[model samples]
Structures are given as structure tokens and as C-alpha cells.
Target: MRHLIRRVALAAALLAPAMPALAQETLRLRMNGDVNTLDPISTTNFTVRNAAYLMFDTLYAMDETYQPQPQMAEGTEISEDGLTYTITLRDGLMFHDGSPVTAADAVASLERWGSVDGLGQTLFSKMESIEATDDRTLVIQLAEPWGLVLDALGKISSNVPVIMPAEQAATPASEAVQEPIGSGPYRLVPEEWVPGSVVVFEKFEDYVPRDEPPSMAAGGKIAHFDRVEAIYIPDTATAINALIAGEIDWIEEVPADMLRYFDGVDTAEAVAARQSGNSMQLVVNHLNPPFDDPLVRQALQLAVSQDDFLLAAYGDGEDRYLKCAAVFFCNGPYATDVNTDRVLERDPEAAQALLDEAGYDGTPVMLMHVSDIPTHDAYYAVLKPMLEEAGFTVEVQPSDWATVATRRASKEPVADGGWNVFFTGWGFVDQSNPMTNVYVSGACDDAWFGWACSDELQQLREDFAVAETEEERMALAEEMQRLTHDLVSYVPLGQAFPSVGIATDLEGYIESPVPFFWNLQRVE
Candidate 1:
């Protein structure tokens, strides 16, 4: 049996073509959407951020255990008063344009990022100055003691801190960079970029990998394939078929309903992509009349049914989803249900009574429906009925994800092309702590979309940052969670465990909060 199996394998190898293999080894991957922009700091879109990970490196990165680890930095020093942080860059760091990665570039990039990001804004508020002392050393001098300095520098999710040349980093945060230049493991092939079709990248042969092994977003990022293509396929069935036919190496967003199709396929495997999964949410515009009322927001929260939303996206199976009422994820460090009983109740009568008490006069709440992304569309499809059942009027304005992304930024009235609410998702890492979560930011006009501003909530978050012990931090976190639910900062609909379809011949895929393409190699 062994001799016959060996003979068959040898015959198949000899029959295969060698021209394509020798010309250029390409790894094709299918993402749910396209990389519309190259500026990592300007937008919070996951697709663009994921693509940027391949071409950019950060000062620090979060490990699998969710702790900050140095990535581009060699070491750091602190003052006795804890108000100064001195970071030194590693040796042999070179950008794609053949320029040395210097402290001036790091300072410029961080300054630009701090102008837009929620956490970066808060960090810079207390910072006296962040200046480059030498070519390889940067110093951050704080006006007071802020405990989340490292956490702000090592943020792993959207709005990642990607170091670039000083000239490129000098651009304003409101504008997007037309072309991106980085010092990561891959270099983007500008000539092969197609707007909605495919984005290509070639491995940077000059990149120097770290000595440590691969972790979540830390350690060495080894590019095993010579070329990589991120192909966009909006249709689920077509992408799945391509994976099964060996036309693509992986699919980022695999629908739960299509899990049965891969049951008999021996070459493809569909599995959970992350350990903690993602949390779905409904963000309401607090600048408008209907949602501007706290009672109205709380009433809408009462009408939400986590199970229904999870069922619509991940089906009825509990294996793919779970009910989590905490503002932070259910199983995370600061998970608490201090004031989430009303949300878990899913009571329509209680919600209707609250709406009546608030004198809601049947105003049409405009719900922005994203047509392209299936998961976000499913959320709105289930959300509209839930709000209506509790005595509120709903108008679902249907558009693609990009249109909704642009429309959500408008603060005008709903009658004037503005929006009342929209739905989106965030990874477990983004919701792990009070300071890191964008939803928890209460900086008034400077906050994330929906703009839930409250001085009390903001103070509580600042207190959480400076808390000296775990008990003190936990207490503050509980207070913040209670206040968040009471204020209805955002509606939390359970968690969804997204799955990915990958060919069995590929290996070294990292299990992270988001999909990464480093250390992945194709088997011969």
C-alpha cells in the first residue's frame, strides 16, 4: 500500500506544470470588501486596515495574551516620575522607498494619528510634547501621569499606528494618502492595483524579521509567498466555489448558512477565525432629536433582542454565537452586567411604556441599511422590526456600505439626508478595555460616530486609566459599564463567531481578532 501511494504521488508531481510555479508564486485571498483607501489613520474600515497590516509595521503590537510587546522598537526607558517615555528604534529598518525609518518619521506619524484616533486624542491631551531626540530615539514627555501610554501606542485594531516617511506622515489626518510607503514584510505593487477587482503585493526581500516567533500582531512577520493578491468577491457562493476549486487560498468572511456546503469537500476546511469573536452593535446619532433623548435611546435598547440578531447572522446554533450583555465582551477582563438587565429582558411592553413617557411623537427614525456586507445588512433587517414593535417609526434607507459610511458622518437632520442609526461590528480586542474602545469615548464632537458625549462617562474612563490596582480598575470599569448602559451609548447585540474557509494544503495561519497573512506557507 505504501509503495502504491508513493508511486501515485510521484506521478502527480511529474505531471504538474512548472512554468507558473517558477515564474512567480502567488497566494490569492478573497476578502469581504475592497481596500478603498491606503491611508491607515484616516478611516476605521477593517478591510483597509487589514491590508495595511501587510505593508506597515507598528512601534508595538499586542500578543496573543493581549499584552503590549515591542515590534519595531528595540527597547524603552522611563523617568522616575513616570512622566517620560524614551523609545528607541530597532536596527536595519528600511522603508519600501529605501529610506531609513527614523525617530522623526515615528514622531510625525504618531502626531498625525493622535489628531484623529479616539485613544490618541486622549493620550495627547495630557502630553506636553512628543519629539525626536536623535535619529533612532524618540521621547514622549507627559504633563502628568497617564497609565495608558503603551496601550495607546500598541493599539492593534482599526486606525493602526503605521510608521511612514516623514514627508508622507506630514499630511493632515483628514486627508488620505494617495500612495502608502511602509517598512513591513510586503510591498504594494502600485501598477497592479485595480479599484474593485484586486490589490497585489510582493514580499519585501529587504525586510528584517524579529527574532521572536509569531504572535497575534507581535513578533516576526515572515512572508512565505513571493506574491499575494487580495481579490474581492462580493458574492458568497462564488467565493466558496473558488476556494473549493483551489483558485483561492482563503476566504475572510464565510457565511454561517453556507457551512453545510463544505461538509463533503476534502480539500477545504471552514473553522472559527478568532478565539473571542466579534461584537455587533447599533450606533445611534445623538445629535438629532429622537436619539438625542436619553429616554428614547434607553427605550430602543429595551426593544433589542440579542438572540434574534445573532440568529439572523449566525443561525440558531449556539456554537457560532453567544449572548453577551456586558458593554465589554462577556468573558473579558472587565465584563459586567451592572445595568444590563433591561437589555437582556427584551421586553416590548416596558420599552413602549418608556417611549410613551418620553413623549415620542411618532418621528421616523432613519436606519441606514448597508446592502453590500451581508452581516451588517442582516443586522438592520432584524433591527427595524424590533424598534417598530416597541412603538417607534423606522425608515430603512438602503445603500452600499461605502455610502452608509459616508452618510453616517453627516450631523444634519434625517429629512436632509442625515441618518438616525447604523449597525457595525468590532473585534474583542477593540472592546477589551474602557480606554481602548471607541464606543466608550465621550469627547463630545471629537468622539467616534454616534458621538455619545457625557462628562461623567469621560471622567470615569480617565479614572480607570490612572487606577493603581486591579480592584480599583475593576470597580471603575463596573461604574463605566453601568453608566454606559444607562446612557445607551450604543446597543450591544450578542457576539458572532465568524468562520473562514481555507485550503487544507496551506498552514501557519494565525488565530487573531482579525485575519492576518503573515507566516502562511503553501505546501508542495
Candidate 2:
């Protein structure tokens, strides 16, 4: 049995090609969605985030144990009272553009990121000021002591705290950035980019990997290939075929339906190399009608079924899917069933009563459905009529995941290109901790997509941050979960654990929650 990474992953069944082994130089792989916005702070999609992980470096990164490890920072100095933190940049750090990374660059990067990412907003609320005290040093004066500051800085999720050149990082969070500059081992090759087809990257010769061995998103981010090309192959058959024919070296994700195609294929080996992860969320825009009424939100929550969604998405099985009953995650360390009693019960009659009581006047729910992910189809198929049965009019809007990423940002009314509901997922890593969870932040307009806000949610998160003991934190987590149910933050459909196919000849693939490109090398 091969050593697989992460807590749980799909038995990707093993992967690679039938072609003769060759030295790894330029690795070729493909994925489902197109990289939306390279501007790290502007978007939150798996495609863009995975690419950003390659092109950019952060102040801190997560090790295998999920602890914060210094990436570009020499070390962090905190005042005893925890009211102040001074971070000094690692010496000789240089961006892909050959510009020296300075303390000012990191300050601006954090500022811009805070304007968008949910965790960043939390940090901003506690921050009195964050400025460069010297070329190599950043001094953070907090309004109060916060324990998750480093965790926020080291957030490994999308809208990640990817440090950039001060000028580039200065781009307004509302606007998409044109440049993709960073200090990571791989430099994104812009000219080779094709809008929806291919993205090319070349290794940076000047990159300085840390001395320690690579682990998770930290340590030495040694790039073993001279070039890496990610070709968007939305069709699983095409992607798998490419892998089998040696036309492609790896496929980031192999859809559940395609797993059968790999059975007994000598050259193909799919491994469940990561954890059983990601939740399909039925997001209702709180900024608009229907969803604005907690009663209506509760109605929708009652009508839908997680089992129906999961069966359609991953097929009926315990291995392919997990019955997640909580807003955080189903079975993880901090998973709780705070307010999921109603959610777990599929009651159309009760949902109708709630909607009728809310005076919902048949307002059309602009359900923005994603066409990319194979499982998303199951989401739309399961949700449309259930909402209609519960006294809500459903308008199905169709598009790729990239379009969903942009349109979800709209705060407009449903009639004016705004969205009422949509489908998306988050790695459990983004949720387990109350303070780190993006969906539960309740930062109002600054919240992820739907812009859900609640005073109770915010207060709970703040308290969760300062919590010192495991018992206390877990108790707070339950309260936060309870609050999440009350606010109807977002309806979590279920957990879908998919696997990826990689070349059996390749080595140094680290098992992580997300797609990682560093530390891989080709061998015969």
C-alpha cells in the first residue's frame, strides 16, 4: 500500500500514463475550472486560489500539524500583553519581478486583503494600526489582544494572505488586478495564458526555499520542475484520457463518475491522498428579499435535504460522501449539530408554513447554478422544485463557476443582475475554528458572497478568538454553531470527498487540504 497524505481522501484509485518514464522537466496537468482572478485579494475560487499558492508566498504558512510556521517572516515578536506584534521580513526575499520584499509591501498586502477576506476583516477590527516600523519590520498595534492574528495572517484558504509588491497589493479590493507578481518558486507566465484554456508557469531560479523539509503549506517550497502548465480540461473523460495517453502528466481532480474508468488500468493509480472534505453550500443572499426574512431562510432550510443533495452529487455511499449535520463540518474535531435539527428534517409542509407566514409574495429566487463541477448538477436538480414546493418561485440562472464567482459579488436586487442563491464549497479547514471560518464571520458587506451579518455571530467569533482552553473553545464553537443555525448563515448541503489522479512516476506529492504544486519531482 502506498503512503497517502491528509486525514482522508478518495481512493483516487492511483494515476499516471502508459507512456515510458521520462525525467520530469515541464509537468503537464489539467483541472476543471478556469482560474478566475489572479488578484489574490479580489476572488475566492479553488482554481484561482490554487494558482495563487504557486505564484505567491505569505508571511506565515500551515505545517502538517496545522500550526503556523514562518514563511517569509524571520520571526514574530509579540508584546507580553498581546496588544502589539512586530514582524520582520526574512532577509534577501525577492519578488518574481526581482524587487526586494520589504515590510511596507507586507503592510499594504494585509490592508488590501483585510478589505476583502472575512478573517482579514476580523483582524482589521482589532487592529489599531499596521505599519512598517522599518524596511524589514512591521509593527501591528491592536485595539485589544487577539489570539488568531497569526492564524489569520497564515490563513491557507482562498483570498489567502498572499504577500505582494506594495504597488500591486495596493489595487482596490473591488477591482480585479492585472498583474500576477509574487516571490514564490513558480512565476506565472502571463503571455502563455489563454482565457479558458491554459495557464503556464515557469520556476523562478532565485526562489529561496526554507531550510526545513516541505510540509503542508510551509517549510521549503522547493520547485522541482522548470515549468508547470495547467490546462483546463473541464471534461473528466478528456482529462483522464489525456493522463492515460501520456498527453498529460496529472489531473488535479477526477470526478466521482470517472473513478470507474481507472479500475485495473496498469498505469493509472488513484489514491485517496487527502481528507474527506469540502461542503456544498446552498448560499442565500441575505442582502435581498426572501432570504432577508429569517423566516423565509428557515423555510428554505427545512425544505431541502442533505441526503438528496449528497446522493445526487457523489452517489449513494458512505465513502463518496459524509452526512454532515453541522454548519462547521459533519465529523471533524469541532463539528457540532447546533441548529441542524430542522435542517436534517426534510419537511415541505413546515417550510411552506414558514414562507406563508413570512408573506413571501412569490418573489423569484434568482438561483445562480454552476455548470462546471459535475456534482453541482445534482444541487440544481435537487433544489429547484423543493423551493417551489415551499412557496418560493425559483429562477434558475446558469453559468460556469467563474461567472458564479463574479455574479455572487453583486449586492444588487435579483432583477438587477444580483443573485438570491448559488452553489459553492469550502474546505473544512476554513471552518473548524469559529474565528477562521469565512462563512460564519458575519462581517456584513465584508462577508463572503451573500454578505450575511449578525451581531451575535461577530461577538461569538471575537470571544472564540480570545478563548484560552480547549474546553472553553469547544463550548464557544457550539454556541457559534448555534448562532450559525439561527442566522441561517448558509445552508450546507453535504460533504463531497473527491480524489485526484497523479503520475505514479512522480514523487514528493504532499497530502494537503488543497492542491499543492511544490516539492514534486519526476522519477523513472
- Best model number under lDDT: 1
Candidate 1: tens digits of C-alpha lDDT, residues 37-154: 6778978877788888999999989899878889999978989999999999999899999989999999999999999887888799889999999999999999998877887899
Error of 1 at 417 (Å): 4.5
- What TM value does model 1 have? 0.92
Using all chains and alpha carbons, the TM-scores for the candidates as numbered come to: 0.92, 0.92
Off by over 4 Å in 1: 1-24, 415-417
Candidate 2 lDDT over residue span 235-344, tens digit each: 66766766665556777667676788788776656666356278778887898987999999999889899888887766744686777767677777788777788778
Give the Cα error of residue 371 in candidate 1, in Å. Answer: 3.2
Off by over 4 Å in 2: 1-24
Pull out the clashing pairs in model 2.
8-274, 8-275, 10-272, 12-270, 12-271, 13-269, 13-270, 14-269, 14-270, 15-269
TM-score of 2: 0.92
Which lDDT values do the candidates have, in the order given? 0.83, 0.79
